[model samples]
Target: MTALPQERRVVTAIPGPKSQELQARRTAAVASGVGSVLPVFTTRAGGGIIEDVDGNRLIDFGSGIAVTSVGSSAEAVVRRASAQLQDFTHTCFMVTPYEGYVEVCELLAELTPGDHAKKSALFNSGAEAVENAVKIARAYTKRQAVVVFDHGYHGRTNLTMGMTAKNMPYKNGFGPFAPEIYRVPVAYGYRWPTGPDNAGAEASAQAIDMINKQVGAENVAAIIIEPVLGEGGFIEPAKGFLPAIAQFAKDNGIVFVADEIQSGFCRTGQWFASEDEGIVPDLITTAKGIAGGLPLAAVTGRAEIMDAPHSGGLGGTYGGNPVACAAALGAIETMKELDLNAKAKRIEEVMKARLSSMQEKFDIIGDIRGRGAMIAIELVQSGTKDPNPAATAALAKACHAEGVLVLTCGTYGNVLRFLPPLVIGEDLLTEGLDILEQAFAGV
Candidate 1:
């Protein structure tokens, strides 16, 4: 087997000559509304190193926001996808079905958390998957109200915008959001109203009580949540939170939807984050790393619930494009063949050790949390848990200047999440952590 790249070899300052030229071109050609990190333009990426247009090599830690878990250009993914492209690209599964699409659905039904004879529908983005999941739930339960948690991020679509909690980029100026979308407190341990110990289950129960009293469980269609909150900070719900909510949904006849878009495909040390809690959701939305960087998303749920929407209810023109299906199959194969779940666990072990050490040394690191490779360090003011967004931003910039790409997320933008590809090597991983430590020290 070919080994992954190691070490950061900075040939020129980041955004080197070629990158500078490309950046100028990008400014003119691309939309200013789009945002990017690490101005360096990538020419090639394999395993952990992203070779930029200037031929400068940098260690990757973001994994394209956890979308390339098997690596940016895994041999398996490339080979399979290329062959499929040669054959054909799109023949929308809705208009003209294809075997590849059915194969992907079969794989999803078998691998998704539940084993209740599930069915699946595909979409092009996470937001679409979430929207369709909600539609399916409402159709199945015959209810209008859908509940979402604070600090949860669903997507950028109209309905998902209301489901999403963040306001700045995702929801700002994009109102009036869809109605019947309710927001409740999440089981955020660090900023919990109650302490972290038993607060998770308590918060969940309390939220359910509010829904019952306010929205009325009978009128609620689904409770959509990220098993591990993604853009709202990589906050993993308290131990009992997911199970408690799922049980409440089951008892109240409300659908339970797990949004695993950012935490699926072995990113959280499991095939799906919901698997960690051992709770089976009625519907699950997935994207991000599902197709190894291809734009593919899916909603998998109990057969009856998925079939609730009338014959022509759930579909899109580009939904389940053959090329994306092929890529997804390849991505799944790569994950299984390389044992990426175990690789994620291994990355977690390294992260816990390094971040724990950093925590002892740097008061700025308020909390370190996440499962497997989906880890994060929340920055805070010295001697207090107050979010320190400025410090986080400075640290990220410092890392980027040093040819180590990192990403910042959290409601306050005070959290640095490390979502390196599972295939990253120990040497590069340690080097990236070293740069982070230096950045913290410099700050």
Candidate 2:
């Protein structure tokens, strides 16, 4: 294999011939439920570019939906992962543990918010970590009810599906979901009915009231939230909202879980988005950027709470696989070596400025939000707050055709999220933003 160059070069159409052929095979053999944001299949990825099968090098803005935060193939990550692969791959952590797994857990304990005694359990995906967090919370508190916010996305598993707020693709017809899960209003300032200033106090008070009246605090096992809402369009909770909620949970003995699946690692300019507001959660669920591109996730929390589960209750056949643990270590190495938190902050400054300028120029670009490299723009009707999913789709399509990959998200499907790799070059990122501006102009 050759080294992937850090440049966007389009030698063929967006999908080209090879990708289209592969798409046909995928359609016939793969599940219809699995969806693709952009149909371009990649052969190699590094820095800010995804090289597809047809020899088209597209600037990546999605970072595989925030999975490849250190870039698709950071040198440190590849080196460590390759060494681990050469040694050995598996041996369930439960039956036989490895230093790599333990080391990753130690890193999580040190990196996650709160300096108090902490412990961690590993899993394969964010959903597993989240589900385990709830289970641990329930076991520790002896409670039955779980609380989540509107427009938040936890995962796709049966229990997480119940916890997730979206209905169409994530929850539609997937019902018979786990019981005792409750939904409450989130402090989404942009769309707050009473206006942004009142969103913080009002949403928190209403949510607390609902929990008290509808599901008593004694019955609540946990209150889970994304410090910066991920699939919910990167809507950071309004000021005073998260602290208020966290304090309420602490007062009532409810475990406060920060689902940092998409906002963790250096994706949000901080180790975790919870740090942005100085709110320390009782439990934190992390994945995505944790292990570069490998499948690894964890639930780290107060040692007492994490240890509540039975001895044999938490282990899984593949939880904390050695190779993935190695990859996570390497990813952390890259983060520290490059100061990706600072890089993410720089990206946030760059992107927010660019997107804010675009917002000034485009009436459809309603709001610019999110922190660090996880920024997004919500599309709305010309001069109103009404969501415009059609324009969102059109803009994304236009960018994809021009060899710049982007992603669309949110409950109304009106958000264009930009999760460029933290290691992306200033030139490539600026060029991608340029393409995005042109796409908006075309739209």
Candidate 3:
């Protein structure tokens, strides 16, 4: 295996000749719907660096949107997946189940935040896992209505589209979406109508009231939420909000599903972000970092609730492909051996400290929120909470030009999110932040 130099190096233009040609080819061959944050094309990536075809080694602050928390090509992940590939590729778990799939399920049951008898069903993406969680909840509760939050992002599937709050890119023209999905206000502290202090109590109370009066708690099958909301900005619900919602769901017999796809797998210092609030969800959807970049997702929850569906109800052919399972096992091993949870906490400390300092200098940085390595800076008009999407776009472009891979998100399209690999060196991280400060100044 070739070890890529972790240091960032820009030998040519950001999208040099080689990447430019590839981008042209991609435009012709690939669909326009598949959006990319950066125009440069990577030939190799490892240890916090994405080596593009132009020989530009860019610092990876994105980590493929938190899919490669152990770095793009971790040793254990590569070794196990390679061994599994040589042994066998696909033997659909349904037709001929394998030990790797079962092992992953066992790990999920053990690692996810729960002390109950847990069970898991694998899938190929976060969206699919979420879809299946809804199925399980509906089957178990015998209800049709599902409650979601205002700024929560579930997935891109038909059902998830209906659950998602944003309409521009995710839901627009993709409708009409699946019925029986309801969206309610989230305890978004920064823009909370009353104030951050009251956000938790007021928002959760209002959300519960909506579920009771409008959807009717008895009619609700599930109340799914990202413990820390992704896509709709990395908005962590106000403190006390999660417990309140979880309690409300429990009081009403509604299956509480924690969509921890992005915030799970040590990205947020804990095994799952739900643990932060000591909230034990009835069902948790996981993906992204689960397989160290391989496409794998799962719905892990109470065994009784999970078994609600029939034998033939919840699985896909590629749900637990043996190779992907091997990768997952390796990824989990890496997380344990390296103590990535602690590393994630260290990252939170370092990043939040640096970003908090930056917020002092840049008024556009309206809010610096998020936990652990999964952090974000909400950009806004100077001295006001008004979103500054134009400034966000320009700043991202600036970072791109300087060979730093940063990403942007938010309902108003004005958040710069950071999800660097947990294994990244402090040197690279500090350098990336330096570039960020420079980019902000230029903006």
Candidate 4:
């Protein structure tokens, strides 16, 4: 068993001489639009550490944007994926067929919420699964309108780009996006105009009313939302909000799709974030942590709804590639064996206690929120709710320089998020937080 050293040891400056050379190479070889939060290239990453080319052992808190929840190169994942690779990498599920794909879908149907008969289709990424989910919903309902909430991030595809709310990098200049897509207010408790207590009912009412009046619920196919907003700063929509909206969708024939791409697979101390709200979305899109770093996504839902798509209507060449499916099966085994849901809860306890203590000391941390390992702190000006993106940037830079990988995200770009792998040792997790505290002080 080759394992990471599970320690943070910076041998040189943040981006040492070796990494500097790689940066120059990347600048020329990679497209400028492709961005990286931390520029130092990784030589290997597993457990809680990422060893960069510069030989700096940085504590990983980002988890490859929540993809490595079972840990990077997990033993089970590597073993299973390696076995599949040896047999064959791809026959393409759409072209031929494979047991691996069928097994993964069976697992999804069994694991995902709802007792009803369910079915799933695999895809290469979260965006593709989401697009297909929308396709299935529209086909089933015979409607064209799709509703998404504010601060929701679907993907970068033409349809998903229209679904995503952010403008600067995701949507700006990329116009003529897919039409019949409508946006509504999410129950963002922190920044809600009315107040957190009333955010659920008020926001739900507003959203339902808008869908009925503006988009016409009769014409709406799906109402897609993230149970815990990911890039939108890990905002957990207020309690009662998801349920109310789900009921409305049921009243109409609209599919309530939960985009659990970032908050699924034990990341939120549950099989899926929707489970927190007792929301069994008619269709659910999953990815990110599904395969322990492998590229795989699934749209799991009611059997009838999924069957609405014709035989050739919902598949891609690389959809449900055997290697990825094998990896997903391995990841599921690891999750059950390790009881990662409980591990994620423990992480939440540790993080919330530490971050709440920090919040008392530092006024810049306006709000510390999120469930399980998926947590974040919204940076703000002292004594006010004013967003402070500058401070957010400075703090993240400090953490990076000190060999702790932290990521920043928000509609205003003023929130710092922590997504350490569930397999991280307590000592390493604590050390990462210590570095984060030091970063805060320095900033």
Model 3 TM:
0.99
lDDT of 4 by residue, 156-255 (tens): 9999999999997898998889999999999999999989999999999999999889989899999999999988889999999999999999999899
Better of 1 and 3 by lDDT: 3
Off by over 4 Å in 4: none
Model 3 regions more than 4 Å off: none
Per-model TM against the reference: 0.98, 0.99, 0.99, 0.99
Q: Evaluate residue 316 in candidate 2 and report its C-alpha lDDT on the 0 to 100 scale.
A: 82
Across residues 1-443, which tens digit of lDDT does each residue of candidate 3 receive? 12998899999998899999999999999999999988898889988899999899999999999999999999999999999999999989999999999999999999998799999999999999999999999999999999999988999999998999999899888789899998888999999999999999999999988888898899999999999999999999999999999999998899999999999999999999999989999999999999999999999999999999988998898998899999999999999999999999999999999998999998899999998899999999997989999999999999999999999989999999999999999999999999999999999
lDDT of 1 at 190: 87
Q: Per-residue lDDT for 406 in model 3? A: 94
Task: Find the number of clashing residue pairs for candidate 4.
Answer: 0
lDDT of each: 0.91, 0.94, 0.94, 0.94
Clashing pairs in model 1, backbone N/Cα/C closer than 3 A: none
What would the per-residue lDDT of candidate 1 be over residues 224-314, giving only the tens digit for each residue? 9999999999998888999999999999999999999999999999999999979898999999998988999999999999999999999
By lDDT, the better pick of 1 and 2 is 2
For residue 139, what is the lDDT in candidate 2? 95
Instruction: Give the runs in model 2 whose Cα sits over 4 Å from its true position.
Output: none
